[model samples]
Every structure is written in structure tokens, then in C-alpha cells.
Target: DAGITQSPRYKITETGRQVTLMCHQTWSHSYMFWYRQDLGHGLRLIYYSAAADITDKGEVPDGYVVSRSKTENFPLTLESATRSQTSVYFCASGAGSLTDTQYFGPGTRLTVL
Candidate 1:
């Protein structure tokens, strides 16, 4: 009730299907980010929003889409999920200050078959 939360904690879908992962934060942080964690690799940023209505692509942006029309919600969509998209997705929020800490959601594990 006081932190970030992600929906569909686990999912299994076929290739080419569209998948949307939801993230909501209770702190109303100004900065939100989407990251992907694959086996044997660190988390890779897929997208980020500095504030509501302002978003930017990160390290890996292809095949993914994001929107932030509200400050507390950031939704990540896989336009066409592929096997390569199988991984754990994380949603995080920060206070937008240098010293502020980033809070992360539990994470959503997506498997594309």
C-alpha cells in the first residue's frame, strides 16, 4: 500500500502477441523507468519518463512502447513480443533529485513462446 506495484507478476504468451505490463507507484515520484533483466545480464533500460507526458527511449527501445499520461502510472507495452523479449521486467520510480533513491516494483516475469 506504500510502494510500487506491478501487475501480471508472471505471464506466458506466444510470439507476435502484444503484452502490456503495468506499474503504479504510491509516492508520486517524478521519474519512472522500465528495465529488462535477462539471464546472465544486468538490467537494461527500455524506457524512462522524466515527468508526466515526457518520455525517452533508453538502452533498448525497439519493439517496446511506453506512455505516462499520469505521474503515478507508467505502462510498458511490447508491440509484438518475441522470444527475445522473455525476461523479468521491472518498474522503478525516483524522486527526480540526485540524492533521492529509486524504488522498484516486485517485477513481472514474461515468457514468450
Candidate 2:
């Protein structure tokens, strides 16, 4: 089973452009998360969802948007992508609650030029 996975393992785009990254899980996990990996910030949360149709902004959601319309999918969009948005984006899933152990995807490396 595909526990949790991400698409377009790698992406490249120009500044001001827009890009969408996809994440999927087969377990119908109750919680899903979006995060970006940077040099200093490390892995910082961008957004998250408690369940289908329920979403919330995380520590860093300024240049990104996310939606979870179904239990097994969560996608993130970089609206008007910026150079600083260049980072390895990761999608994670947790079975029970926010504090539960989360499994991470392989990650999508996005480059902005």
C-alpha cells in the first residue's frame, strides 16, 4: 500500500509563477500536514488538516495554500511562487490526533529561478 506519497518529486519554475504539489495516502489518516525544508528553519509546518474538509494554517503559510477535500489526499499550492519558496516540500500523515506519530513522504524539491 502507498502509505503516504508526493508527486512531481522535483519541480522548477520562475518567480511569480504558480505551482501545485500533490500528496496522497492510502490509510485515510485523520491528520495531514504540509511542510518546507530550508537551511536554517529546518522542517517548518506550512499548513495542516484535521480531517476531510477541515484545514488550518501552520507556522509558515504566507506564500502557500493547502486543501484537503478528501481523507486520502492533500495538496499544496504556491500561489505566485517566489524564489524564497524554493525548498524541499514534504507531506505527512498521522492516524489519530495532531500529537500522533506522523509518516512523511519522499518529498518534492521545488526550485525557483
Best by TM-score: 2
- lDDT (Cα, 0-100) at 67 in candidate 1: 98
The per-model lDDT (C-alpha) reads: 0.94, 0.94
Candidate 2 lDDT, tens digit per residue, 1-113? 76898999999999999899999999988999999999988899999999998999999999888888889999999999999898999999999889889999999999999
Off by over 4 Å in 2: none
What TM-score would candidate 1 get against the native? Answer: 0.95
The list of candidate 1 runs beyond 4 A from truth reads 98-100
Per-candidate Cα RMSD to the true structure, in Å, reads 1.3, 0.8
Q: TM-scores of the models, in the given order? A: 0.95, 0.96
Residue 20 C-alpha lDDT in model 1? 98
